[model samples]
Target: MSDGFSSFAKLFSGYYSDKLGKRKEIATFGYVATGIFPAIIAISMSWTVVLIGRIFGWMGRGIRGPPLDAILAKSIQEKGFRKAFGMHRAGDTLGAMVGPALAFVLVIRIGIRDIIWLAMIPGISLQ
Candidate 1:
């Protein structure tokens, strides 16, 4: 459900990025906002608060995607989009793989609740 709204938000985000010529501003803000969502969820005592956090996080992720794509495309004209995006996707996949691997190791020491803080490290760097 969070992703559903996020998917919808992506369209508008892409449009606004192009329309405003502010991809850097919009995407930077999205990264910062998305980073904070997990902390919000971890801190929430009520499911309602968690739900709100999820929605905002999803929207931030959605908003971040397209402009980043556009920026990547624009920045790498020499190599062409196919190569650049391919490398970008590889890194994304690597992160996805590494995240779980790290979690699997750290979960033993930290447990799942505290693992949320681990997720925040990369997210917090976006700001």
Candidate 2:
């Protein structure tokens, strides 16, 4: 369900990023949305709020990807594209692995809501 929103958002966001030539700003909006929404879920007491937050958060994730790639592609020289993208992908993969593991450990210690709050810290820094 969230994926549907994400998929649609990715298509439109990518189109606008190109049309506006504002990859950085669009990407920043994505990061802010992704960050803030989960924190919204943390404070909310209703399942509907959680559902809304999750859908928007996933859409934020979708919104960032293409513009980020566009920024990376623009910034790097052709000769170093492989290396640069590889490093970017590596960092993403590392985060994917580490985030859940860290959350799993933190959930046992601090609880799930706190973990979600903590997750917002890094995202906030992106802005």
**lDDT (0 to 1) per candidate:** 0.86, 0.91
Error of 2 at 123 (Å): 2.0
**lDDT by residue (tens digit), candidate 1, 3-113:** 998999899999999999999889987787788887888888999988988898888889989999989988877658788899899999998899899899999998876
Candidate 2, position 111, lDDT: 96
Per-residue lDDT of model 2, residues 16-106, tens digit only: 9999999999989889888888988999899999999999999998999899999999998999999999999999999999999989988
Most accurate candidate by lDDT: 2
lDDT of 1 at 99: 88
Model 2 TM-score relative to the real fold: 0.94
TM-score for each of the candidates: 0.90, 0.94
